[model samples]
Target: MELVEKIKKSSVTAFISRIPKLHLAAVAGLGAILLSTQLLSNNKTPERQRTTISLPVTVSSPSIAPTIAESAPQTNSAAQWRTEKLKIRNGDTLSSLFKRAGLNDRKMMNFLAATDDKASFNKLLPGKTLEFSLNKEGDIEQLSYVLSKLERYTFSKDNERYSLEKELREPDIRIAARTGIINSSLYLAGTDAGMDDKLIMELAEIYGWDIDFALDIRKGDSFRILYEEHFLDGEKLRNGPILSAEFINQGQVFSAVRYVHTDGRSQYYTPEGKSMQKAFLRAPVDFRRISSNFNPRRLHPVTKTVKPHRGIDYAAKTGTPVWSSGDGKVIKSGYSKYNGNYVVIQHGGGVQTKYLHLHKRKVKTGQRVRQKQVIGTVGATGRVTGPHLHYEFLLNGAHRNPRTIVQKLPKAESISTKIIDDFHRQTQPLVVQLEAETATLLALNSKGSQNKAL
Candidate 1:
């Protein structure tokens, strides 16, 4: 009894000395632990015994860590640069664009140059988008141009401030395409699927010579592309070189690849080196919608007679622009009772194109016109319906289906001497990862088949 009283008195002093500031629950837990340890030392107190298990220390958990997670005061923004995009509307110039982007300076003049300054600003096309990334200081860190696809220019900074540097933003093209089905034009489907309009344009240009994009496209047609894709900062920015493409129209699948020979002249090819782009495009204009079909015996909606419709009619708003079929010389630009204000283009290799019922003729006789150049406008000037353009394509002076023109992509040159070294250096890591993942997938696939067999 005297020993127990002396032990209790010593424990009171120890608790007062070290454990007064401890939490109630912690103090109770610690007292129990110590009391159990003491009792464990005594075989006479077996029921009160306890075993202590120590925790392994971790990197984040110190021996004397505080019991709570504390967060620091946050003041700075997380983003160093924020990307922004704006589409060019009519009457928008680079100066206005710069102003809108909060860069009210003469810096754009340094970039546009005097040689093409006025032309660049005045020749604004609608739906063209320009992208820019703004740094924390509100200065433009980078500019992305989407003329066809994205081109980026980065700003360099030394001890002083930032300065823009022109950098070639290549397509980072991968020969690739995806099959899509649409009731209308491939243009509609491509843009709908977030496919870059520039890529769609390139695809059309490549196959312009063979496929008549207007009359040949049908519902349930699927297309595939093996084309170049672009990337910036490991994120896909736009399109690059189109290595190959396949478009299905009216149950026909058309395919082409970029082919470069030993001499360095490149062209779009079939599995064979057949040109996808011919001397002429299958049709002169990408008509908005087909208003009339070629029929041997059908009543004219306007003429009210059972007449042979030799050509196709495309519907568009009045003054909706028309384009030339191919690079050609204007053979005739005149008005006739049957043809109205019409223009005829005589192409190379005995091919010919005709456009009738124009609102106004853009080219005069003997003037040269390139493919996609403005030829005229849609008008009800001829012996036809409301606002529509009558278009015709003749090969050796005979009618062929306009949609059969094969599109040939421009050949992509080998990684050139200038960019090849840099491209390899930049893309090596991604290539390695992609290759490794592909190998892993192959191995797993093989293993799965073996398991299935068993």
Candidate 2:
């Protein structure tokens, strides 16, 4: 029995010596568990003594949490290069521009020869910008040529050669609204409402088929437009397409919403899915006012005699563009004493339109023209008149009023049944928003009036 006890003690000592330093506590606990089990199995130990010899044995593996110093820190690529931006001024050549960036002509020529897309860099326009990223040795390591707000060309240097990469970014489009009430003219009111000329013209063209801006616009007419504002790098780049609009003309409300088809074709339509475009425009030119209307018996300004006026006269500045009302072919484009430079177009379904007293005819005989295409410019070359366009619309053989005849003409095709549901899904929200905004504007105006009266 003595020999066995000595052998057991030596075996435990050898086991303790073999363990790692970090795991000494765990090994000691495991050895205590083995000794307790041996004491419990021996018949010589008393029950009370065995119960009193209590030792809690917990064995656990050692774990060390990683510290910050264990791994390498990450570095930003931009930190390695310094950037220099330059804008090309007028009369600045590529060599001069490169010199401005601290680069010599030899380096410029080397870069140009190494780049495969040298054609785009050949013609550098004024006001375009370029960025050069240099290394610590002041050598051009990267180059970025900004073509526009959304497009740029990047070149990266490797050894003595450079590789080209094109990058394109899409502008962030955000929806916005504008409202205006006409006091005298649409143009003035639109400008007063913080809109540019291009946006005003677009608004007019949207309702051009129904309202003649030169003749039918009234004092109380109001308009609310929902449109897109393109933003890049947290700044507005430009205004995008008009999403929807509402026009209240003399108490008659007209609504138009834009929808983009799956094929990327965009057009305006009413809430009922009918197109807002008609077969003919209500006015062929964007004139300030109408000088004369169609009259069967009227005293001529030049002749001072009773003569039948067969067309509406739009008074505008000379060189004001005149557009074709619909798709047709020019049947006559000539100069005469009464109608200086004029163009007559013959459309399908026995419809024809005539433009008299043009500064210059853009279309020739037998030439095709499309709707809204500029065919001529308003002029005073006729027998007697100022700068005005005499626009005539004829159906079959009888002349018709340009303002009232448009309502009688058929509108462009409506949304097809196959995509009517999709159209509604896209346009319903815009229609609702348009209505809500117009309502808010009306409420504000009413409150302002009440305050004034009080």
Overall lDDT per candidate, in order of appearance: 0.67, 0.88
Model 1: per-residue Cα lDDT over 390-445, one tens digit each: 88767787875454432432332344555444444544433344335445645766
lDDT, model 2, position 230: 94
Superposed Cα RMSD, model 2: 15.1
List residue ranges in candidate 2 displaced over 4 A. Answer: 1-113, 118-145, 440-454
- By summed lDDT, the worst window of 10 consecutive residues in model 1 runs over 405-414
lDDT tens readout by residue for model 2, 357-384: 9999999999999999999999998786
Per-candidate TM-score against the hidden true structure: 0.53, 0.71
Candidate 1: C-alpha lDDT: 0.67
